[model samples]
Target: MEMNILIERLQALMAKGGRQILGIAGPPGSAKSTIARGLAESMGRAAVVVPMDGFHLANDELVRLGRRDRKGAPDTFDIAGYRALLDRLREGGPEVVYAPRFDRETETAVAGAIPVGPDVRLVITEGNYLLLDTPGWADIRSRLDEAWFLDLGAEARQARLVARRVRHGDTADAAAEWVRTVDEPNARLIAPSADRADVVIRLDA
Candidate 1:
């Protein structure tokens, strides 16, 4: 769908005059953050993005659990915490609600980094597992007013993933290997959840 049309749709939803949550779900490197940020920018103060990446487990915790290598996998996040934030966003109180944000530079979650005030009408949350039916993740879909799955060709998506890792300081060979052994498996797990989304969108590169 065109970005303009999606913006219009979100505007219409916001017109109802209560907080609305929109979830954008897709595999790694599907540009979910980009799209969510674009929508929030277009909407100005009425919208705020609270990304699921912020729920990522600390690197220390991942290492302790022996899951550091598969850091982006399903179990690598604090799903309960993520869900609790969604609940608060959905409830909409008088006070400001602060949300965590993931810092790629340090690879850690920065607490209370993004604030969602009471006046914000829409909360756009994007992540890989929003539509997953797994134990902790299945509750996510029900919290959103709408859910969108971003789709991209596997080869193109994988290439982007590799490039991202390299840009983040991984050697080219290490990035390629990580994409093969780690990201690809997560992508496969995520693909099936697309069927659960309210809309599957394929935006142009």
Candidate 2:
């Protein structure tokens, strides 16, 4: 699927008069967040983004558990916390829900950082593992009405990721090293989840 196709489907769904909770999943640096932002912006106020990164464990906790080195690993986040938030969103009840937000600069998830209002009809939650139907992750699919798997061309996503790491304070060599060492492996693991997505998208810059 292309980006325009997604926008078309979104508009169609909106026209049909039912809320669409669309999930976008992909490997690290695959442009899931970028697509989510675009979707929300295109949808206007009816769409709000609630990121899965918001459940990232705090730095202190990760350090305490000796998982700082593997900061973006599956175990480094509070999956249950994310689960609760998704569950609430699925219910679509009245009242505002304040969710945590991940800060890349600080590398931590700050509580009550994003406010999800009562009237938001669509939510775009993007992450690497939302479509992963693994042991502890089976709960995610049930929470989302539909999910899209973002598939960026390898060279493009990797280049974007390397530049991102460099911009965020990593030396060029170190960032490349980190991307190859940790990020690439995680990206490989996330690919399998694409099978579970309702839509598979190949997005390009």
Candidate 3:
């Protein structure tokens, strides 16, 4: 829903006992990272974010699998790597754990990058596949204490995705075509998992 309500919900969750993990699940263009950042900022130092984009396979790895052309598709990522990170983070291992971070311009994961430290209690991890039940991602929701799904209009989302691709160096036509063809199918498949979320929110107008 709205930002104020979302912040309140998070605050309430944070107030509860023990450690809490918040999973923000949405389609590719749904602005999940933006919301996660905003919420963490609002909460000040208590919240820290770890994005799922870090799990995306490098360009070379994608090429090895012959899936470079379908980068946003399910099979293009390193699913086991992501699952392992989640498991490690959940176990409360070392004083700090370095996670991968995706660079949009380069379209690759930079490893040992994002740091999750001992002080941060609430982990806000946003990703498209957090709610997906396919293979490695199936146990994802169980690991997260709270999950939210961001809902946005299809046409608006497609526009955002197209603009993002274009800004990241894809030709305008190519961006639009990729949004229509590749991303939208994934979005459709990802949408149903909203039902699994504890909260469903529509972005502001």
Q: After superposition, how far is residue 74 of candidate 2 from its true place, in Å?
A: 1.1
- lDDT, model 2: 0.83
Where is model 3 poorest over a 10-residue stretch in terms of lDDT?
Answer: 86-95
Per-residue lDDT tens digits for candidate 1, residues 38-106, read: 999998998999999999999899999999978889999999999999999988989899999999878
Clashes of each: 0, 0, 1
Q: What is the Cα root-mean-square deviation between model 3 and the actual structure?
A: 1.5
* Better candidate by lDDT, 2 or 3: 3
Tens-digit lDDT track of model 2 for 1-205: 5668889977776675656678889988888888799889987888888888998888788989999899888878788888888878767778788888888877778899878788888888888878777766778887887788888877888899999988899999999998889889889888988889887877766
Residue range with the least summed lDDT across 10 consecutive positions in model 2 = 11-20
Top TM-score hit: 1
- TM-score each candidate: 0.95, 0.94, 0.94
Cα lDDT of model 1 overall? 0.92
